[model samples]
Target: MNRYYWILGAFAALVVLLAVGLNLNPREVPSPLVGKPAPAFRLAVLGQADKTIGPEDMKGKVWLLNVWASWCVSCRQEHPVLVDFSRRGNGTPIVGLNYKELRGDGAIDMRRVPAEQEVPMALERAAGWLKEHGDPYLLTAMDIDGRVGIDYGVYGVPETYVIDKAGIIRMKHTGPVSPQVLNEKILPLVAELNK
Candidate 1:
């Protein structure tokens, strides 16, 4: 019947659409927040809870807001690049948003690793990791509950945002910052925004 044929056609179309979506890279996913004002949040600094930081504090400066987690493997991959970039002191400041650091059962990864060896997911743990791995952030804010991350449309860890001096989000890079991404996308944008 024609009705049966129509149902088959619709099913085939859905299958094709799903296949295309699966092939798409998540990193290339366009952000709705691009060209919009960065989300605002004031949170306690990782190591210093008494001191808070937010978008308002960096209103007049071009900055990189790097959302990282101590547990994210991709963050480790990008750590050296961020560290080197921070040391270069290219005029753009780097701030860190430490998101979802605490876990009720203390499980940090999907591997289901034992809790005894699992890294503690707390602000102190993040501060320690930064100290041992080399702290690159001019200021680091703690988002233990990940509410701020939701506001910024974060899909996962290791997302980086380039905010212009006026506090507008110019670009967002999802995933580890490879040298090529830093050189080709971030650095050039930083130079342009600074000017």
Candidate 2:
């Protein structure tokens, strides 16, 4: 019994050490998107019948992509910031990935798709959302099939990423971008891109 107790104690200590070591030695999983080019997507405005939009649409310009949904209140919270950010328009335009909406059809009539458990988020609502709050993004598209979201490693709505002029992702933010984050992180990053 004494020998068994000693063995159990030693095993417990080893487990604790391994846990602490693992936590300290964090590893960054190679994002399939890191070194290579970003995944291409072609989509259109919610109700506009004007033109088709795709990654190639903005080629040669530094941009930002936000993964958001109408059903996500946090996304709603971040919406206005996007508007404000666009108002700055430092040549870095913001775009939206409206996850939870179809496949194939580039033109997403927000009025038509099931809005994440049937919650509606029309372009008018998005426009109103910007009007009441302000407008930032130049392009906003419906990721009806969630394929774009998965490609960008999005586990939730309201996440934002800064894609460089070369189309490589330069930054990732998982929550609402606060004013502090904007001033401290976003501005500096954008400034560098501009130079």
Candidate 3:
């Protein structure tokens, strides 16, 4: 019957849509912030209470804003790549945005700590982690309350942003920065942006 043919066609269309969706990479989720000005925030530098830094401080330079946390397992995976990049001293400074360091650590949950002591406790943990894992940041800023992360439209930890000399966000990598991603996508963009 004609009605049977219409139902079959609709089901086939739905199947095709689902198949197309499945082929898309989840990590390739497009960020709305790309091509926009990098959000501003002045937060205390990790392990340095007296110093605070923000995107404004890095104007006129192509820089990377890496969103990470001591608690992020994926952060650890991408850290070695960043460490090697920093060691190369390629002229692009990586400013770490230490996001939401309040949790992680079965022995002692930082979330249960007093509000006044939370930042300090988180800093201590982060500093220790960096010392052990190797720090790649020119200077890491503490986003204790995660307000800065929220402003930047962070979906989760381990996101990275490539900001141009003019402070516009040129590219946003939603997940860990592997060597392939660095060499193929990030480095090429940085080279072009610097020119």
Candidate 4:
């Protein structure tokens, strides 16, 4: 029947669309922020509430703005690579934006706590994690409540942006930064931007 043929055609179309989508890499999602000025933000340094840092501080120097959180499993996976890179003294300063810190290990939700206690609690957790692993950031800015992350169009944690000396966002990587991504994409770009 004609009706049966129409339904089959619709299902086939849906299948083709899904196949195309599945073949695409989620990490390569294009960002509208690319080629635009990095969003401006002045956030308190993690564990150092008295101090603050922002994109303006890094002007005239190529830098990496890495969005991470204590709760992100992927961030843990990506941390060592960053630590190694920093140890190499590549001259590219990496500024960490600690996005929405929450205890992700099936523990109490940090949101239920009093507002005044939130930052300290998050800082405690993040400090412990960094100590256990390694702190790669030149300075880590605490983006409590993730407001800065929202301004940067963060869909999730563990995102990274390469900002040139002009403060324009050159590249946005949406997922964990593997060693290959660092060596192949980020490092090369940073080298070019620094020149």
lDDT of each: 0.86, 0.69, 0.90, 0.89
Q: Looking at model 1, report the run of 10 residues with the lowest lDDT sum.
A: 102-111
How close to the true structure is residue 52 of candidate 2, measured as C-alpha lDDT? Answer: 55
Which pairs of residues have clashing backbones in candidate 3?
Answer: none
Candidate 1, TM-score vs. the true structure?
0.80
How many pairs collide in each candidate, listed in order? 0, 5, 0, 0
- Cα-based TM-score, every candidate: 0.80, 0.68, 0.87, 0.86
Using alpha carbons, what is the TM-score of model 2? 0.68
Q: Could you say which candidate leads in lDDT?
A: 3
Candidate 4 per-residue C-alpha lDDT over 1-195 given as tens digits, one digit per residue, 9 for 90 to 100: 999999999999999999999999876769999999999999889877689998999999999999988778899899999999999998788999888886433466655888888778889988898899999999999887788898999986799999999899999998899999999999999999978
**Across residues 117-171, which tens digit of lDDT does each residue of candidate 3 receive?**
9878889988998999999999999888788999998877899999999999999
Per-model RMSD to reference: 6.3, 6.4, 2.8, 4.0
Task: Report the Cα lDDT for candidate 1.
Answer: 0.86
Model 4 score (lDDT)? 0.89
Q: Where does candidate 4 stray beyond 4 Å?
A: 1-21, 103-106
For candidate 4, the TM-score is 0.86
Judged by whole-model lDDT over C-alpha atoms, candidate 2 comes out at 0.69
- Ten-residue stretch with the least lDDT total in model 2: 101-110
State the displacement of the C-alpha of residue 4, model 3, in Å, after optimal TM-score superposition. 14
